[model samples]
Target: MKSGSGLKDRLVAQARAEGFVDCRICRPWDVPQVPARLEAFLRAGYHGQMEWMAERTHWRGDPAKLWPEARSVIMLAESYTPEGDPTGILAHPDRGAISVYARNKDYHDLVKKRLKRLARWLIAEAGGEVKVFVDTAPVPEKALGHAAGLGWQGKHTNLVSRDWGNWAFLGSVFSTLELPADDVEVDHCGSCRACLDACPTDAFPAPYQLDARRCISYLTIEHKGPVEEELRGKLGNRIYGCDDCLAACPWNKFAVAASDMRYAARDDLNAPVLAELAALDDAAFRAKFSGSPIKRIGRDRFVRNVLYAIGNSGLTTLVPVAQALTDDPDPTVADAARWAAEQLS
Candidate 1:
C-alpha cells in the first residue's frame, strides 16, 4: 500500500509533465452507474449508427470487464480551448464552422502519443502491463473521469471540468498496478440548462442524455447516406463536429487556454469558405486535411456537409456550386447538392 501511494503521485506528476492538463485515478469498478446508464442509452437507440457501441457493451459499461487484470484506470484530460469564441463563425454562414478540436491536427494522434509516453514511464516505474486508449475505444471515459475526480458529467453528457471546462479531450491508461484512487467528483451543473438550450438540432432528449441521430456532429462526421432533409437547414454552416453545447457552458469562465500549440486552430480551417470546401475532390480534400480529424469523414460526407452549409447560407451565388455537385459521383453528395440547389431556388 505504501508503494501504491507513492506510485500514484509519480504517475500524476509524469502525466502533467507530458502535457496532460489534468490526471486522476480510479479503480476499474469505480463507475457503478455506467452499466445502467449505458444500457439505457443503447436501449433508447441514442448511439445512432455507431453500432460499435453496442458490440462492446459489456466492456464499455464495466471497465472491470474490459480487462480483468487492470486494477487502476487513469483518466487524463488535455485542453483544446480555443483562443476565441468557438461559436463566433456560425454567424458567418458563408464560412464553415468546423469544431474547434477538428480545426487543428487530429487529437487522437497527439493525445495517444502523450498517453504512450506516460504508459511507458508507468511500466518502467511500477513494472505493470498497460494499455492506452483515446476516444477510439469503447471505454466509458467520461464516467471513469467523473469517478476519478477530474470532472462531473455535465448536462450535455460531456465531461465538464470546473477548472478546464468541456473544451478538453479525454484519454485513458489502464494499468495492472493497484494505485490509490481519487475521490469522485459530484455533479456541479446545478440549475444551468445552457448546454441543453444551445443545441441547434435538439439532440438532447433530456439533460444528461443525447440522441446522436439528431446531432450535427454525428450527421456531418459519422452518418452516411443522405442526411435527413429536415435537419440539414438546422446544421447552419457547421461542416464538421458541432461545438454549440461546449461553447454554451457557463463553466468556461474558469477555463484556461490550451498550452499545446498543436491544438491551435489553423487559419484556413478557422473560416473556410463554403463554396471552396464544396468543390474539393477526393484527392484535394485529402491534401487539404491530411493531418486533420476532418479527413476521417472523407470527401463525400464532407462535401455533403458543405452542401448543407451552402444551402443554409442563403447566398444565391453559391447555388451554382451546389447545382454543379448535383451530379457528383457519390450519391449522398449528389443528393445533398440537389437539396441545396433546391433550397436556394
Candidate 2:
C-alpha cells in the first residue's frame, strides 16, 4: 500500500517549507507525441553546439529509461526575479549586462543542496530511495515540470510559471515512492507573440522552439571562438545571457521577489563596467568571480566577451583597454580586442 498521507499535498507543503518557491508532481513516462517534436527541433539543428542534446535523444524525453525504478518526479522551482527589470541596463552601453542567473553564486550548488535535503526527508517519511537532478540530467525536466503543472512552456521554450514568471531555475527530485500527479497546466501563451518579437537575435524560428545557434546566452556563455562577426554588434553590452524574450512576457507581472538570496543581484554583477572586466587577468578574474557561475567562463573567454561588448559600446574611452589585449597569448581574446580597438578607434 502507498503511504497513508496524500503524497502530493505532503510533498508540496514540504517543498514550500523548505524554501522552494513552488513545487509540482508528475508521473514518470514518455512525453506523448514529443519524439517527432524533438526530432524536428534537432533536425532543424536548434541545439547548436550543445551536441549532448542530440546525442541522448532516447533517455532525454522519457524518464522511465533514465531510472526504471522511479515512480514519481518532483519538479521544484526557485525564483531569481530581479529587484528591477534587467532590460534597463541595455541602454548603458559601457556596462555589460550579466544574465540574472549568473548575477549571484551558481544556483546548481545552492539548489542541489536543498533538493538533496528535501529528497532525504521524503525517503525518511515514505521509506524509499530517491535521486535528485539540477539542470544537468538526461531527464527532460522542463517537460516534466509542465506535465506536473509547474508551468507552461512559453514561446521562448523555457518553463514559465504563473507564480514565478520566467525567472525560475529548475531542479528535479525523482523518487521511488508513488505520488498522485497534479493536473498538467495548459499553454497560456495563446495569441501572445511578445517573446517572439522581442529577441535581439530572433533566436526562435517558430513558436516554442529555440534555435540555440543564434541565442545570445549560448553564444556568450556556451559557444567558443570569435562569435559571429555580424552578430557581434547585435550582442550589445549583453556580455552574458539575453533576457529580452523572457522580460516581454505579460505573465511576468505575477512574479514575486526572489526567494533565494543567492539568486539576488550582486551590486558588482548587476552592471559590470566593460573596461573593468576586460582588464581581469586570470588571477584577478578568479579572485573576483570565485564561487560565482561566471567564473566558469574563465578570464580568456570572459575577456573575449568583454572585448566584444567594448566594441559595441562605441565608447572611445575603452579603446586603450582593448588595444592592451592586442598581444595577449590567447588568440581569441587578442582578435576580439583588436577588432574592438578598430571599431572604437
Candidate 3:
C-alpha cells in the first residue's frame, strides 16, 4: 500500500473533511533556502529571548533532517479569522485587546488533534510511518506552507493565502510515502508596507524581517521580568499577543470563516476591561482563563500585562488598580504596576 494512484486526491479530500481549510504537499527537502535565512535571523539576534530557536538549527533549518525517512510533508491550514475586526479593541484604551488566536481555546491543542487524526488516516491508507506536528515542534511550518502551495510568506513573515487569507494555523504531517508535491506559491505581496507600518512598537526592521525584542507580542508573552521602560508605553492595551500586522493585511478581505466553532472569540476575552483584569489574584486569574492560552503565562505575567494596559488607559479611574498591584509578590508584576501607576498619575 505505497502511495498509489488517486491517493493524493483522497488524502486531500480527507483533510478537507477533517476541517482543514486548505491542504498541500511538498517533499521534505524542498525548502533549500531556509538555512541561510535562518542563520541571518539568528546572527542578528532578531529571535530575542527565544533561544530554543537558535538551539535546533539543524532540525529547524531543514525538515529533511528532522526525520530522514520522511518523504512528503503534508502542510495544512485551518482558518481562525475573527468574526469582528480584532484591532477595533485598540481604540478603547480601558480594554485589554487579546490576539484573535488566543481569544478562545489554545490553537496548539486544537490543531495538533486534527493533525494526529490526519496522520492516522494517512498511515492506514498508505501503509507508511507518520508523525504530526502543530507549532511546538522545530518544524518550519511557514516555509513548508509556501513550498506546499498553501500560501506564501507575506511581508510580515506570516503565511498569506489568496484563497484563505493570513489567519490560518499551519500544521504538518510527515510521512514516508512519496506523495506528489504541489506547485510552490510565489510571493504576492507587491509594494505593500501595511504590515510594517502598522506595528505600534516598530518591530519590523524591513519588509519580511521582524525583530522580536521590539515586538509587543514577544515583550508581553515571552520576555520575562520587567519590559524596557521605553517599550512599555508603546504596548498600548494589548495584554497578550499583538495582531497589528495580521489585521493590516488587505489579503484578509478574502478570508473565510473558521470551520470549528471553538475558534470563535469567547465573550469575556473579546475586550476585557483592564481594571477588572488587573484585580485578578493567582486563583482568580487561573479560574478566569482556564483552558485558555493566556493561562500559560501565569497570573504574574498576565497581571503585569494588564497593569501595562491600565497605565496606558489614562482613565484616571484605573490608576488605583495599578496602585494596588504595586506591592505584588512577583517583582516583575510589581515593577509593571509601579510603572503603570506613574503613567496614569
Candidate 4:
C-alpha cells in the first residue's frame, strides 16, 4: 500500500492501460437530479417495452437507493466507433447492416471481464468489496458518467463524451472505497438539433425525450411482437440497432479513433448480403453470429430483423427469401416474413 502515487490516479492510469477508453470516479451518494426527468420519461411511457426501467424507479435515479453502504462509483466508457457511417451499407438492398456496436462481439461479456479485472486490482490495493454492472443493472451509468466528468447527457438522452462521441457503452463499479469524485461535465448540445432531425421515426417528442415505442432499435430488437406496421418500411437495411442519432451528432467530429483491435471491423458483419442473411436457419444463424452481440437476441428475433430489412430493401428479388421464412416455426419470424413478402409484391 506504500505506492507513492495516490490511489485514484493510480487506478485511472491502470484502467486506461487495460483497454478501457476512459475511467472516472464518483461518490455513490451523488446520483444525478434524474428523478423528475426519469419519472416524466417513464410516466410518458418513453421506455416502451423495457418494462424493468419503470419497475425500479427508486434505484434508477439514486445509487444510494440501490446500496446505501456503497461509497464510490467508478464509471467507465468503452468506445465502439466504426471507421465510417454504418448507414452507407443500406443502399445495398441485398445486404444486411448490423449496427456497428453489435457486429463484433457481445460488449456485456467483454466489458464485465475487464471491469472484474479492474475491481480485482482495486481490491489488491484497497481491500474493498465491489460489485460491477453493465447496462443490465439498475445503476444509472450515464448519470454517473456525467457526475464524473466523462461526459454530459446530450438531448438524445445518451451520454456524449468529447473524446468518445456517443459511441461508448458504459459500465460501473460500486465499491466501498472513498475515492474522490472527478469533475462533472455540462451539457454542450446547445442549438444543435441534428439528433432530432435525423431520427427516421420522429421518436424524439422533444429535444431531450425519446419515445422508444417509435424507435427502430426498440422495435427491431427489443419489442417481441410484430413491429408497429407503419414503421417497418422505415427500418431500412438495419437489422439491429439504429445509429442515425449518434452519427448525426456534430460533436462526433471530435470523436476518438479507436485503437482496440478487438473492435476493428469484421468483413462479414461490415455489410452482409440481406438475401444470404434472410435464409439462415437456427443452426446457420448460431454459426454466423457465434461471438456477436446479436446472437443473444436469438434466431427468431434475428430473422425478424432480417425480414424488416428485406421489406425495406425496395427490391422485388428478395421476395423468395421472405417466402422461405414465412413458415418458420417461430411465429415472430413467420409474421415478419409474411409482412416482408407483401411489401416486396
lDDT of each: 0.91, 0.86, 0.92, 0.85
Candidate 2 positional error at 151, Å: 0.9
Ranking by TM-score: 3, 1, 2, 4
Cα lDDT tens digits for candidate 1, 296-328: 889998999999999998999999999999889
CA lDDT for candidate 4: 0.85
Span of 10 residues, lowest total lDDT, candidate 3: 1-10
In model 2, which regions exceed 4 Å deviation? none
Any residue pairs clashing in model 4, and if so which?
94-274, 95-274
Q: Residue 43 of model 1: what lDDT?
A: 96
Each model's TM-score?
0.98, 0.97, 0.98, 0.94
Q: Give the winner by lDDT.
A: 3
Mark the regions of model 4 whose C-alpha exceeds 4 Å error after superposition: 1-5
- Summarize candidate 3's per-residue lDDT along 87-206 as a digit string, tens digits: 999999999999999988989999999999988888787788988999899999999999999999999999999998899999999999999899999999999989999999899888
User: TM-score for model 4?
Assistant: 0.94
How displaced is residue 62 in candidate 2, in Å?
A: 1.4
List residue ranges in candidate 1 displaced over 4 A: none
Rank the models by lDDT, top first: 3, 1, 2, 4
